[model samples]
Target: MKDLTSAVEHRQEHRFARSRDPRSAAKILVYHPEPEDYVVGIRRALPDAEVVFGSDPDFLRQHIGDTEIILAPRFPVEALQDAQRLKWIQSTNSGVDFLVPVRERLKNTLVTNARGVHGEVMADYVLGTVTMLHWDFPDLLRQQAAQQWKPKFVDPLSGKTIGIVGLGAIGAEIARRAKSAGMTVLGMRRGSARLGEPVDQYYTREEFDEFLSRSDFVVLVVPATTETYKLVGAKELSAMKRSGYLINISRGSVVDELALIRAIGDGQIAGAALDVFEVEPLPPTNPLWTMPNVIVTSHIAGNPTEYPRRILEIFFENARRYLAGEDLINVVNLARGY
Candidate 1:
């Protein structure tokens, strides 16, 4: 009889061995708006490696040729044409849509993301927004502005159903918090019927409509991918409960912005809390900015005071694995677009 677990371990070992040769000496490029102590941490972790620090396109272009590794939130995809020796890229951001522009060029490059780091803060944002909508925070704000003394009935979060569209790290954290608040947590993910802690029920993509119908709040946390592009369209929006609120902490492309505007205008759903947009800066002329039922944030959900430190922890650990010829954490499957 074959030992399945040992066989799986051996297969993984062989796969990583074929991926990259163990090399302590490599050129690393650090390009981020707020790297903080990342360069220092990377230096300590990979003492033999040469580190180049720059945020300007010209400086990055000048050093791209010799860069074996890159640590950044975003990089110019077009400039990657000059990076002849690039082997791996570690994105400080969890979503890697920034790499989509040059997906073909990254076929051979190993890519990892800062995934688990943002969950806590992002979950807090979702909870806060959900509570605001449920408790009618907007009405109170308007009353304060007009010096009115009206008291509106608020809905309790207890026993309310929250359907999280993606059961990744961020979604799991949200489920944890929602469950702690006595809310019924439902989760939708790619596959598997198994229910984990925090989530009481699990649904696959096939059962998305049923999930939407059951939820009092629908949260989208899926990554931006071809399969997920506009995953929440008019049809999906119309399936939700009339009083259901939508919260998007994921990529803007994951939901149809135009469809969302229509849904809100037509009262297909109660309202939405959006942290990301299809066109960011979201344009001053965009209707969402002035919508009474909607709450728009400039995509700062994952940005806490400790965000840089958290991201650096992932990067530093991955650097150790890269030099030790071990499989890296959060290695993105380019084909899967996660």
Candidate 2:
């Protein structure tokens, strides 16, 4: 276990120490590659917990049955299913789709996420991609390759409608930047009506298509769930302004890849900047890879900066709350998937 990053330094270690209750501290298993990189800080955070850190799947499988709390980015579902005394799980990723495999077994356990951490970096990346989509950088690059100098007028970010789906932490940051750039920000989510939100207008789940039709640019940031699987399909694409562009920073399953390909081919939508796909490493034969109008990035929207220091932040706070008998933050609802 080697600390690959300086993320869990001394200061963060002391922040949690004051809040932890020695008597209430439970055994914590930090399962990650080179688990020691974070173990020192985690141990300092909850001084009384029996902190066993490991990178081996077999070691995790061997110890998981007696562990009360698990902080891991990856865990064998079979081992996860056998946890006897597990009370809480701190998932390192904002999206907990991986846990779907063990959702039924952990009905009694609490699940939380590292969501807000990616907000700033992800928003910056999404907005940059959105700008590329709007400016038709692909076309410009093609012209550059052809050595053709054709200047075309394009609308500025200001006054253009930018609709955000799944207005969570990432979406909110996007809205803030869009607003700063003078763009009209529209947002959709379960309870987007909350006052003081960054969005200029809010749409509910029922008005999904209506929401889709109005935006000049649509950004998908929703979680991948049964309700959101292929949330953007043929009809949904048809709803958008044909000139509009899509920027997906969400899971690939959230959008229908085949429908998106067909839509792009037929010009149902202008183009897309895709960071995720239905199948990762996006099969070489996939049309999106070669499409001049699309930008495909291997799922890296959340990590413009690595070292999940933010996830550890969430874990630290939650660990304190768990020991203090306080309500945890980022508690996930498995059924809704956010």
Candidate 3:
């Protein structure tokens, strides 16, 4: 019988023998309670690569010895030091600030993120919240409680404009949905002057104030990076139209929670829908919980039951590219911090 393992070994033998550096098999460790199919699919995509399953942090510590790549939702900053063999890390989530310290220390390790997967779910969440606000659901709830049939005026989605702070996957999807609902859509990002499909206009960071001034609703979908931290704080908040509403489906730290409180308290903006906060499990005493004009959720905007399957698809695609020595997709640019 022919040796299948030797066939794979022969294909890599010349590359191994000629290189001054040792050519070891690529080994990946996945950290998260991910679907088994995710790991299995990636392994199938790169048959020669060694894939290990480690759902717990303790298992991660023990298995870091041979890990050349890590598929993680989040991991301890200390893991960067111990995982000396780690050459890359693929985060299942968009925000990576929690991994910044580790990223800084592991200068050579490449980092990729799942940027496109969560867009649809997040867009749907934003649209739902915005629609609820436009229809005055809160006011209607009060009237129901009081047993009153008071008629009130509500804003129409057709004539209004929505400004998206980031034109990435999530922002683009939001634009598409908002436009289909007859709202004018605008977006602002650090680069790219042109908007795709549904966006009527695109602005650079310098044009943020202009975008804010004209928007009746502003949606934030940017990731939490050095450049985006507190990007929508006091000054930005003050730039918007007083009757304008704000929606944050991005990370909490992207907006200054204190600044937002002051802005809303002073009636700087009409209302806000926040899905993420600076602190996880926001303390019961947090003022945001009591604010009448605010809608707060526990960071569930981008979550969907299909999340694991979507994440696995990206991993498998990248894993196949890795085997072919192709440049990986969605590779994070450390300097730009996306």
Candidate 4:
């Protein structure tokens, strides 16, 4: 596989070479709620730039025409037509699905994301979830709710194998932690044959079935895209070991919700720990919510106490680069939809 670090650096350099002169007084918009210090930091970094903050759609729409840059988790695709001077968007979230709808309008604009910032927190969530499922923590919780005591034998993670579907920033971190816990790590990447310390074996998409068959825990970390939409469905789930667990910290669309519910109900796979879903807030009526073996968390795997601070660091660094006419980091490849 191409060294992700080098690939990103090369892309940044290429984009910087084509970049125009830095605007002396660009209008910036922060469409998400942020700490006061974050706004101060941006102002400090771009002294001459005009910065505005608002969470309302109307407010953002009114300012889109003059805004040159936007730092937000989500933006109204319909407002792109009014953003005459918009040149760049820095997404606070790692995934850029919010911008996918307006991709054509963004053809001339640069987009960057908070990719590296999420690795640690997300890894922690993956590790915790995997262990909880493996040790039957949900059953224990149920017993507690009944005011009864029960003990059950549990499998150890040390001797088991973990398959990480996406070997990106978050996936790599999960591999590292899983390896440290004594699990053999099997990783799948789109390209590159290089094997690393944490990963015992690397499988390309062609070997996905083999990867699934060997994993005791399958972790999904890939971004949501046309190619990834419902990437894991009935066939893939059926290929997994009956005792294996699935963990998804990626977008909900990556897994077919109906197939997953059926798989769990039919005992095709052991269980799943889901942090994201095809729908947010995961409606109370959803079967996954009521499934005994399933563990669900509201799309908060990457949210940590220091998330704002960490993301702000990325934004500030990129803002400085923007003002200094240097290459910005974590630049997104709009065509790849990451």
Candidate 5:
């Protein structure tokens, strides 16, 4: 990986060195290729902006010098410094971990995320999964597979308590949907400050255990950050009700894999619905796959059929805000890592 990165960087350096005109709006730098509708939406949003698409390190280094802003699916961390004119970065991913490399270097550049764009889609996923579990859909499937027609009692989502670990756009969306389902929504944020939303109450990190103890379902939507690393572990998992379920849509590392495995094995929580994992592709040897109570997905929570177009909408909205000298929406707080 190191050798491949070095090679890419070397190519980028050559692109930067060979380019004669470092300033051209027609070549506004974009990192990915063939995002037809996304590109169109961006163009429509910034009519005068020029768009350039390249993933090659060399091409990026050379062409980024004159780029005013980057509408990237993935930020070119190593090549960001090459773009002397870069004023802002619109990331396709909600998490801003990719920006860690340039956050300090590009102090003057604004960083925004596709926070709200993917919220509804992800919320739908969570809502659907929660409903299936509540209605004993899994057991029904099992009975059908076994050639038996056993009936089971089920409960409604109404009056159940849902704990939202993060209150960002996605979390807020989940909270709204869960509440509308008649579940009492309890939010656990880093602070106690109230956000304009439908949360019944909010708790701080200090109250995480207390919050977990009372929830029927605990959903994690926090970002990946040093502070959030292993936020949910043995002790936290132990606090949950034995009849409750845990749902994770956030980065995988937020929950400790070993602890989670133990929790489920010991029936600490009823089940789990995991989108992300500590390791990608969830290595063949991982036990979580075979765990009867755990439902695993290959990190598809935020991926929607219209993902690219929705992201472009946010880009256009932010572009309008940026040019108008207004506060951009979904701006990331580097200190908090959201």
Candidate 6:
């Protein structure tokens, strides 16, 4: 496979390998909860490869030993223990942070993710939430439910500042949409060096508090990693404007759940729209469910109706490149946990 490299500041030089052709000795494991949905496409993509599809753990253990490639949104990390012929693993999900813990086990395998596909849908979701907050739609719905006709004025989004916590692919999409709305886009990432993106201002790692204080609506689009786990807590929350709103499309662990509840309860910040949570299905006893200012959505922000179509596209294209002994796209840098 091709070796592509050019330093992009904080980003890593992605490495790919010349893989064994499926027609030869390569064996592939196509794993999914519903394997029937993908079998045809997977087979069509790798016509000469030996492919096995299943979701059962026993089935996985039975076939994973000599598999050269495994494709799925998720699978048991433990199943990779004896995957000696595993040359690569294609993840249907964009974030590969979950594999950080078992980095040592995957030392020889190349990991690629569905990174480019989620940008449009996720950006649409984030922009939808932002407009809801800016126009006070939550309160308007409450009044409509109460049969009250109280009309109110709202500030326009044109002159507002939107701070993006992580400026990756999805974050770039969000920034583009926010900029189109005439809002000033402020972005913060670990890298201080600017690559000339669309953002109006770039905030360094040390300027987090000041960045938080200036935004009208803050969006969290970071991945889940040790450095980002509980990245937002009471102190971070307290730094924001009391009237500022928060939109988190990232993992729930990125924000401290307990601290978030207290911050909203105490009116430290205005409110939040959360798509991911620490506990899924968010227990009936959790206070976030009843908070009039909060919006709790199940983790459905990324994998919408067209998810399978886009993710499979990435998988097939990369499969062609891998089989042709060319560069594979979206190869992840495990050390950085993207």
TM-score for each of the candidates: 0.89, 0.86, 0.85, 0.90, 0.85, 0.91
- Deviation of model 2 at 330, angstroms: 1.5
What lDDT would each prediction earn against the true structure? 0.83, 0.80, 0.78, 0.83, 0.77, 0.82
After superposition, candidate 1 runs with Cα above 4 Å error: 1-25, 44-47, 193-195
User: How would you encode candidate 6's per-residue C-alpha lDDT over 1-338 as one tens digit per residue?
Assistant: 22211111212243334343323645678788876656777667656667799889898888988787888877888888877667778988888877888988887778999998888888898899888877777889989899999868877899899999999888888999999999999999877535656799889768899999999999999989998999899999999999998899999899999999999999998899999889888899999999878877888778667567777888878766764556778988788887
- In candidate 4, position 182 carries an lDDT of 94
Off by over 4 Å in 6: 1-25, 192-196
Task: Write the residue-wise lDDT of candidate 3 on 1-338 in tens digits.
Answer: 11111122112112111111244466678787863866777666666667788677788888886677788888776756676566667889887767765556656666788988888888899889888878767767878999999867766789889999888778888888999999999888766555346878878788889999999999998878878889898999999999888999888888999999999999999889999999989889999998888888998998878777788788777655555555677877666667
**Candidate 6 — number of clashing residue pairs?**
0
What is candidate 4's lDDT per residue for 1-338, written digit by digit as tens? Answer: 11111112223423322222333456788888653665776777666677898888898899999777888888778889988767678898999987876788887678999989889999999999988998878988888899997767766789899999998888999999999999999999777745564899998887889999999999999988888999899999999999999999999999999999999999999999999999898998999988999999999999878777788888877766664556788888877888
Instruction: Report the lDDT of model 6 for residue 258.
Output: 96
lDDT of 5 by residue, 1-338 (tens): 01101111121111112233323333456777655666676666655557667667787888888776677777558887677656667788888876775568766667788887778889998998888666656667788899997767666689689999998778889988998898999998765555568898889888888999999889999889988899999999999999888999998989998999999999888989899999998998999988877788999988888778778778767665554445778887766776
What lDDT does candidate 2 reach at residue 134? 83
Q: List the residue pairs that clash in candidate 2.
A: 1-36, 2-37, 3-37
Cα lDDT for residue 79, model 2?
87
How many clashes does the backbone of model 3 have? Answer: 0
Model 3, position 116, has a per-residue lDDT of 83
For the record, the alpha-carbon RMSD of candidate 1 to the native fold, in angstroms, is 5.4
List model 2 lDDT by residue over 1-338, tens digit each.
Answer: 22111112222112122223333546788888866656887776656667898878898888998787788876787887667777778887788887876788777677888878789988888889888888889889999999999979987889699999988778888889989899989999876366667788888878988888999889998988888989999989999999888899999999989999999999889899999999988999999998878998998888845455667778878766655556778888886776
Q: Which of candidates 1 and 3 is the stronger one according to lDDT?
A: 1
Query: Candidate 1 lDDT, tens digit per residue, 1-338?
Result: 11111111121222322223333356789998766577887777666778888888898999998777799988877789997767778898888887876778876678889888888999999999999999778777988999999856766799699999888888889999999999999999887644565888898888889999999999999999888999999999999999999999998998899999999999999999999999998999999998998999999998878666788788777665654556779888777778
Candidate 3: C-alpha lDDT: 0.78
What's the ranking of the predictions by lDDT, best on top? 4, 1, 6, 2, 3, 5
